[model samples]
Target: MTEWWLWMYVAAMAGGVVLFTRWRADPCGVPLSEYRVAIAIPLWSGFWYLVMALGGGRAEVAGHTLYWARYADWVVTSPLLLVALTLTATHSLPGRRWGLMSTLVGANVVVILGGLAAELTADATARYTLYAIGVLALLAVYGLIWGPLRAHAHRQPKEIAAVYREAALLLSVLWVGYPLFWLIGPAGAGLISSATTSLLFVLLSILTKVGWSIVDLGRLRSLSGRGRLTVV
Candidate 1:
């Protein structure tokens, strides 16, 4: 069952790669950077899923089978997703854009790394301590997204502002599921089987990476067609 879900994840990501590549043909004045990030997210994730499906990306950590490759994938792709979303809001504010993006990405790195460490730690106190750190970092991510990022997005043309809001909201909601699943799954407690955890992660990844990218790029295309969006 776990193997089946991993294959499903690989297929989903492959579809994302193909879809984004075809969309790249005519960006309709939308920046190619956005397409590049969108495509990269799925491309990298597909490769990692392929590795896991082949039984090459797991290890016994703290008596639990840990798919560290998932963390490896998230460490890179999550930041890229944030960069894609951040670009939409900060494209018009070049002076402080990179600074804000760097801070957000840095916080995201901590979130992933903390989770990884927690999974590897056997001590209950240490594991929960790491988990708490990750949760805190996630809150920091939300703060940046809702506070400063939303402020910048609102200052954009209404169409672009709307696009940013939708993307941000989708990501914010989907991301909360990761820690919840982690807390209840084999990693944190023995409440759920590994296969079930794999299935849930597969669904979440598809939505967060492929589904979100489709909505983001599609909306950008619509904005471009109406002359409300331009290459930054």
Candidate 2:
């Protein structure tokens, strides 16, 4: 299963590409039209991760392995992920442009990168500490999701509120596992196999990315007064 991670990368890129392509084909020109880059970044970065992995891009230092491509992928995709979420959440808001997304999403990036470094560190204490920090960051993220974000959603219509709530819940659930995943990776104490870790990564990305996009798609339907689509 040495290439299991690579396969996951390939599959995610392929699927995301197809999904985004269909989204482009659709003719929703008002606001769903504006999020092309938000939805597109992850798909693009997913391909880069696959390419870098297949091209044998990896580094090992002090008993720790790093996938440079994955890091690069995160550099672009993480920001876009937050943007996508922020934009989706703000969709129902009256005149809020960025909403709490800038603050919370910036913090999320720091937490995630810090957690990655913690996993690569050899000191158990530091790793645990960093994991704790990541957890706290997520807690704050949840607070914003349920607190300010929810409040904004509540100010909107019922269907809009439903979209924001579902998106937030899905994001929270999917992200809650990331720190754990970091722990179980080549750096973590959980010591899962590479194949298992790769599979988990696939599951996380697919569920979170597609799940968020689908919720937003439903919101699109609500705004456009259309029906639900099996795929967005």
Candidate 3:
């Protein structure tokens, strides 16, 4: 069942790559950078999933089996996802925007690393400490997304602002599932079986990566069709 979920993730990510490729072909005024980032997210994620499906990227840590590759995948792709979303909110890169983006990405890195460390730690207190750090970093990520980022999106034309809102909201909501699952799954309290956790993670990954990208790029395409999107 766990293997099935891993392969399913691989398939979902492959589908994401194909879908994003088709979207990229449209010469809409949407910035090419967005397309590039969107494509890279799933492409990298698919690679890691494929690796895991092939029985790679797993480890026995603290008497629990851990797929560290998932953390490896998240460490890279989450930053890229934030980059894509931040670009959507701030159409043109300004000095201040760069700072915000940097902090957002940095916070995300800490979150991933903290989770990985927590998973590897055998000591309960240390494990929870690492998890706390991760949760704090996640809160920082949320604050930036909903605060300055959302404010910047509101400054754009209504169509563009609408796209950012939908994309940001989708991301914010879907991301909460990760920590929740981690808390209940093998990584924390072990309230659920590993197979169930694997299935849940697979579903969440598909939604947050492929699902969010579709909504984002699709809305941008719609704006382009109506001549509402302009390349800056």
Models 1 onward score TM values of 0.96, 0.83, 0.96
Q: Write model 3 residue lDDT over 86-124, tens digit each, in one string.
A: 989987434338888999999999999999999999999
Q: Give stretches of model 1 more than 4 Å off.
A: 92-96
Report how far off residue 31 is in candidate 3 (Å): 1.0
Candidate 2 Cα RMSD after full superposition onto the native fold (Å): 3.7
Candidate 1's displacement at residue 13, Å, is 0.8
Q: Any runs in candidate 2 off by more than 4 Å, and if so which? A: 1-5, 226-232
Residue range 21-127, candidate 2, lDDT tens digits: 67667635326533575457657666765665565556774376666566566656666666666656666455555647687777777777776677567788987
Q: Compare candidates 1 and 3 on lDDT and give the better one.
A: 1
Q: Which stretches of candidate 3 lie over 4 Å from their true place?
A: 92-96
> All models: lDDT?
0.90, 0.66, 0.89
The window of 10 residues in a row where model 1 has the poorest summed lDDT is 90-99
Candidates ranked, most accurate by TM-score first: 1, 3, 2
lDDT, candidate 1, 1-232, per-residue tens: 3478899889999999999988899877777888999999999999998999998899999988999899989999999999999988865554438888999999999999999999999999999999999999999999999999999988878888999999999999999999999999998877999888988999999999999999988998998788777565
Prediction RMSDs, each to the true structure = 1.3, 3.7, 1.5
Q: RMSD (Cα, Å) of candidate 3? A: 1.5
